[model samples]
Target: MISSTLIFQSEMFSDWIIYNDETHGEYLVTVDHSEDTCYCTCPDFQYRKQTEKFGGAKLDDNEHHCKHIRKVIQDGCS
Candidate 1:
């Protein structure tokens, strides 16, 4: 199960504190609906957030795609 807590919310912005079950690591997630982007205080997210594709057509949804971001979006940003 995913463990997360919504720390802040507003019309266009929100913040979430989520834990990685595997490592039990905590990360701060920020979602901005106005920009249609999400950010996470995690190395994986930081490294891959700007990557469009990894191995010539492997593909990604967008520039701001990651597990933490997905978790936030899954929780419903709108």
Candidate 2:
């Protein structure tokens, strides 16, 4: 787990986007307020289950957080 805290303002939801360094691309990151979760089009998030099973590092304590989450937090997704 990366012991870092990334905070985002509540209003950043509308402008939140996911950027990929490898592909030099960007995608919209959707947040499900009702479910209190976020989703991304990146392959990391798409195949997170397999990644975790293979012992890839988790973004947070649990398997919930990922690079996408870190990006959102670092970008101030408020």
Candidate 3:
């Protein structure tokens, strides 16, 4: 879960930003602006979201965004 008080700092890259979350022992969150994607190297991201087997069906929009991604957007992204 994303905390209302958690703050993140990001290191800018050419196409993505590396978000550093201090609340979780400086965990890194990757935010890809070009692809409008976000990923975290956390257990939650791996177990919950990434484990989904889409099979032959199209993925739902709600399935893509995680708490890390939401934090990045909440920090300041239009």
Question: Which residue pairs show collisions in model 3?
Answer: none
Candidate 3 weakest ten by summed lDDT: 51-60
Rank candidates by lDDT, best first: 1, 2, 3
lDDT for each residue of candidate 2 in 1-78, tens digit (9 for 90 to 100): 222223233532333555556666665555434334565565666675324343333333336555666566565443
Candidate 1 local lDDT, 12-70, one digit each (tens): 87899988788888888876666655667787776656442321111134445666667
Tens digits of lDDT, candidate 3, 29-69: 55444444455565666566653352111122336555655
Better structure of 1 and 2 per TM-score: 1
- Model 2 spans > 4 angstroms off: 1-15, 20-22, 49-62
Error of 1 at 45 (Å): 1.1
TM-scores for candidates 1 onward, in order: 0.71, 0.49, 0.47
Question: Candidate 3: where is the Cα deviation over 4 Å?
Answer: 1-24, 51-63
Cα error, candidate 2, residue 73 (Å): 2.6
Among all windows of 10 consecutive residues in model 2, the one with the lowest summed lDDT is 1-10
- For all candidates, the clash counts are 0, 3, 0
